[model samples]
Target chain A: MGSMARAKVVALSMVDKHPEPQPLLAVKLSPAENPTAEAGADAAAPINSSALPAPEPEVVPTVSLTKVFRNLLAQITRERITTAALACVSIGALFLFWYIGTKYRVEFYIRFKNVPTPYEVFQQLTQVGLSNKYLVNIAISVRRILLGFFIAMAIGVPLGLAIGKYQRVRDLFMPVVEILRPIPAIAWVPMSIMLWPNNEASIVFITFIGAFFPILLNTIHGVHSLDGVLIRAAKCLGASEFRLFLNVILPGSLPHIFTGLAVGMGVAWVSLIAAEMISGQFGVGYFTWEAYSLVDYPAIVLGMITIGFLGLACSGIIRMVGSLLMPWLAFAPGGKR
Target chain B: MIMATAMAETQKGLIDVRDMGVTFGANDNKIIAVDNVSLNVQPGEFVSLIGPSGCGKSTLLSIVAGFVKPTSGDAKLDGNAITKPGSDRGVVFQQYSLFPWLSVRKNVEFGLKMAGLEQSKRNTTARALLDLAELLSFENHYPDQLSGGMKQRIGIVRALATSPQVLLMDEPFGALDTQTRVVMQEILTNIWQQFKISVLFITHDIEESIFLSDRIYVMTARPGRIKAEIKVPLPRPRRAEMTDTPEFMNLVQELKGLIREESLAAMAPEIKDRGLSGFGMKVGPKGVGDIF
Candidate 1:
């Protein structure tokens, strides 16, 4: 008998030997008429009616090298074109919006309807050299942002680690943080001026408040989310409490710390601009405000562009640091944008 | 063939546990994990700890390795009390406890670094242990890049790099496939024969216990006491086929009997009320496949 007939016999015997009635007949048997029509009806009859069924059909090998290569090439081309198209559309759209928006400006004091073109903004950026008052304004902003960022990191990272690692400390400080965190740094400008009596102190306080929460939250999350298994493994390997926290916990939490730093840096840049504009004698925000007062739309656009570019640079540096510190974690699938 | 001499070798204790106990949580909410239990493990011996789930077999092993401090009594290694985890007692955890960031070589060197060995000594010991574990070729590979068996092998090498007197493995092969578990069992046996460091292997597999250990220390449920200390007389470098033998079969039957009794006894009203029907299924057909 053929394999099909032999399989049928085996199936029949399996049912007989077990002597257990299966309530659910999970298997489906197609009518033999289709196969019988394909072959001769008489020829298929004995095979179907036989005590045993056939063994499974052997897999046939068929190779087409050209077809395989064609598919691979098609996949590569499709991916490449899609990525390139996406890049072009995104950059094109951004430039288009910026160009259209800057083409017109309403200067109420000057009563001018149409401003100079977007190219004038680019020309103004080039003319604003090292000695230009605008360049000094840029310098002042960069210095304050950097200083405030560093100060925030100095305070935030350690406090974050304590809050993340210990419950009592987290409880004690969490309420205070919750109360302070909701009060916007812009709103604190009046309070800062009264407390410190200087524009510099106010700007720094605003930047510190703006940058603090993100760094703190990220650091806490990084510490809290450390692998339980890794900690257990470290404990098993005789790692002392100090070594465990420093070597394992610190390194493990670094990725989150970097995330916090990136977010904190962004917040500091934005808040410092607002603070500088509202109170400071110099800096990018003050420069932008001063340009608005003078109705120099090109310089106003320049200040905004410089802020955008500087924020991008700061975040890029943070990302580079994160990748360097966590080379193992860097290759995560889809790469977080 | 089974031999009585193997059983004779395991009688002289290499590891002595005297009335050990452990209590977790604070004051009024305290729960006893392991209550006063004593066990003895001989040098050049493979002893298995088999018990119902939550019976404190793992707790008992952790105490032996000094990973867990006992509330009462002591776990002694070669007559000295084990107060803290040391390089002398190497432990293999259930999960892949390898440092994911480090390559295989660096992971193996971790214990040596902790021991304050110089670079030269650390490299030599790490290399030798890796070679013994048959993972020398994959030395530069990270733990994530390796297969389950390879990762566990690295874990073994890392533990052995310290030249630990006692290999306190807590279900090292528990996460592997049956085929891989068999392969790892052979690898472990070969390593045991070469080093003969007294092994306190904690497992719930009756067949595995029979296949690997020189003696089986069956533990009771809750207040986990030593139920029986049956000597397995299987010859050195035990083959996978030894599990098919009458001696191995009989021992497996005895262990299964003890485990079932203890498992039934452990089925308290609280557990029944909690509806944890699948508890301690490692020693039976219900969840026997889980315990490597």
Candidate 2:
């Protein structure tokens, strides 16, 4: 009994003497003082550690499920309300213009074959999409864009890589490239017709001219921008010259290459429309010119809509591919947004 | 002790460099980076080069790695002249030169692939090295995710993957915090003993040089030349506790004296005019000259 008492006294004295972490030591002594009396206070110490302010708490009330749902709903409602208002304003303005044309400016529509009204243009948009004439023009324009874009890619990518990797090659080619780059794609029409016997080849050459420069320039820029440190690190790792170029240089330049492709596709679409207008017999631009000559107002409107839709579709495809090819470049300027 | 000396004699010179000099630029602006200097490294020995900034310790290691060619003299490894970088010599740079794009496994497998090892063998070798570095679980992690010390360990493992005869380190732990650096030093010492590879380490830390090296070479500043080479008699498989001993302090003082003399010599002008005693740098306040 005496030894037990002495042991308890010694324990209490040690706890009192060493007070470096005073609150913590006191909490421990409290629990020893009463078996179950200070259990609640002992548990409070662990709670104090956790109660310290976290920079970003995990389950913040502001970011809870209910609040997030409410915010999402609010945003969707706001967007819908704005879109509806825009639609109303646009329709009202369009109607007022149509009324004015009907009342005063009749020559605009009357000059066309059979004198169609503004409503006729909308009707033609819905009806002409299913017609064989419209389908053929759309197919022809698409074929021209694809042939030109792919050919430019096939020639430009390898040439750009060579120019980027070798200073001598860049020196030899840069002058010729610069001299030709300033000449517009439409200017190539006259020379292409003389060089290639067929209209298809002429149109393809024009499209290629439009697409090539942007792709090639972007590719060269991409390769030039690769981090020199990455190359040196590869060399230190015993990577052979061939492996270094293939594995490091190529992948490092991919994000830039994708940028070029996106820009090239946009250029190719614009070139296709211009090339078709000049030399095409069966495309959206050619059909629009034919409608103008025959004074078919609704047909002209249909052709314009077709060209706009085609450009939108092709550009969308480019963006989709860019997203797939270089996911890390989503944050890049002029990306998806 | 006698038996150890006899063993060392058998492997008298693992690295023999003679009259090596590295000069940069041409004509009037030419600067001699490393003057005519020669040293030998024995097998399984740890040697360190210590000096102030711009002492050319890194340049000497680069020459040994065959990354740079000396303007004069030769650097031979096991009696063969070095012409290019090979798997025989592995260098750990001051920066954690881990390839960020690759996972830890792929980074470690880089040297094996360069050696033309088969896929199965490469996999096995990479796994073994990762395990040895205590980074087996981080095999799939990229370099950015790992801490600085972990990245350094990966750098060491990458070097070791080639099974090099000589290991070259240019201040491998110079970038770490003090506590972490000590831990890494202990880990490196353990690895060195296990592999028994001759290490040529460069550093500016005097205590580190004394603690880790079997012999420490102190170099003079600017146009660098070896000023002193002191052999550490402290017993090895060195532990952290040995740092507090009297022998360690005595060696630190000796190294300090040698470095102080070399620094004074480096700052002394080429032309001496005893008559103009109170001229140049020493005039005015304690640090008024701004000379480094």
Candidate 3:
């Protein structure tokens, strides 16, 4: 890739690699603009700076292969170095636990040794990374999640608004929503398979079911939580119902809608994986299940990590879209004093 | 056009409230919030409705603004029977209800947009109003970005944007600091004079009412009715210093006595157990009482 493209990829994927948020600990990773101070202020002090090994010297003079590799770290910004160091420590801590737990075969209820170690998982990722079948599995899962999430949004936003505004619409649909909301997406596998013509459709349907409730309920709640004064203000300004809905209700409910969309994106990934595993020709979920059957523990762990990456990407994209749509939220006036 | 004409025919009184009464809830549990209150605001006149807390001042304004219906009497504007909220009777709520999502200019332009003005016309109107209110500089800021006083100025201009025939304000400056309140009162009177628009303002502050109003209506306690109508004999182009004048102070003292009497009655021990004694308001079953 071109240098510009590589930088773009780095910027976009920086936060997308992590499965969980470290909102306080997360720094923006700009070029040495003093991020450590901010990261410290909000989160636990960046994995204790002393615990991080000193960054190797610059690569300007030394040309030995291993030394060159170590010195190459100098090219990265201080913020990135700190982040990388913290991430390395975090991942190392997790692996340390996994290695010790599995080596001793520690048992909670069952044998923890059954789970592959971090080394085993990385080896499996390396073996499968170049394979076309794994790529296709990832492709299938992503396609299902995107399609299902889109369908959920298309159906959820309008329906949510209708249910929110009118009491009668709410009364009519709420019972069904309440009844269906509690059922897990996996439990719907049988019915979804029966209803759809093929596994692809069934898997997408399950994903949609997982996402639909959060967005719908959130939209309804957004409408309910809207300040009555705004509506009154609009009406008193001579706004017709249509105008009121367009100018006030829609915008007023946006903060809530975005929240619902973000949560729905998370659930969509979760359900898509499970649904694909239960019944699918191909997907990361199916790949994991297939690996389990073959007793390929490393490949199964690799699949799990891939799912985590996918979930992070989905949620990250939603967060980006939310900030873009509502610039006001990102720009607070003065200090919050 | 037909509706405007019909409204003109019916609007013999510029703003007519005839023995209007409002009772919230029903039957035995019913509480009379406003009682047989009748008043008017002539064309180009600024009228203030002032009373002790919970004397139904806001409720009366709400009726005129068509957000609430009068149980017995009717509220009419320009001969048109006010039924529902309309642009013809623009309203400025005390809460500074500038849509937080909209910019200051857009907040002012909202009513104009709803009135179906063309883009250029809406822009012109909003800009002129903002310029008049000296909010042109902060026009791009959101409501949350502006100070409380700035937000209320935006609210006032927004109400005036549609060129409503009669403006109804419910304690438009009640939330501001005392200093900001005085400044806002000055800005409001100037705008009222510049536009020559009829106004029906509701406020609990006696000094604020007399400073901006052409006449002040003092209302009695619970089941609020008009107690006395004190016309401001003060000449046009009112200033803050006018409050120091003996005449203004005497009127302030006179109104204060009337408000205190009603306030004492509103605080009467018979219903005091409900935590009823609210300054300048009526006794509602709700947590606090502000209107009678």
Question: Per-residue lDDT of B1-292 in model 1, one digit per residue for the tens?
Answer: 1343464355333788998878888899888888778887777778888888888999988888776889999988777888887777888999988877677898898877766679999888888888888888988876777799999988987887777778888888989999999999989989888887889999988888888888888888887888898888888768888888898888878889889888877886555444456555532454547655
Docking class of 3: acceptable
Each candidate: chain B TM-score: 0.85, 0.88, 0.88
Task: Give a tens-digit lDDT track for model 1, residues A1-337.
Answer: 2544544555455444544323221021221212332333424444454442442222100112333555577678776899989999998897776566555554557633555566887788778845568778878888888888999999999899989988999999999998998887788888888888677877988898899989998999998888776776666566777777776888878888998999999999988988988888999899888889999888887888888988999899999988887766633334442
Interface RMSD of 1: 2.3
Candidate with better lDDT, 1 vs 3: 3
lDDT of 2 by residue, B1-292 (tens): 4654575667532777898888999999898888987986788889999987787889998888778899999999888898877778878888877765567888888888877899899889999988989999999887777788998998998888988888889999999999988988889999999989889999988889988999998888767888888999999889999989999999999999888665555554531232234455554457646654
Error of 1 at A291 (Å): 2.2
| Residue range B1-292, candidate 3, lDDT tens digits | 3553464454433787898989999999998989988888887778999888888999999888888988888888876789999888889998869887888888999998998999899888899999999989988877888889998988988998887888899998889899999999899889988887789999989888998888899999887989999889998899888889999989989999898778767876654444444533654355545333
Q: Considering DockQ, which of the candidate structures 1 and 2 is the better prediction for this target?
A: 1
Q: What is model 2's DockQ versus the real complex?
A: 0.13
Stretches of candidate 3 off by over 4 Å are A1-92, A99-112, A331-337, B1-13, B270-292
Scored by lDDT, the top model is 3
Q: For this target, which candidate reaches the highest DockQ against the unseen true structure?
A: 3
Model 2 agreement with the true structure over A1-337: per-residue lDDT tens digits: 3433443465466544543334433333333343333344434433354443332333233224444566577778776899999999998897676656654655653533354566777788778778899899889888988999999989887788778888999999999999999998888888888999899888888889899998898889978998764565566667787877776777677777778877888887777777778778888888888888888878887788788888888878877886666554443335443
C-alpha DockQ for predicted model 1: 0.22
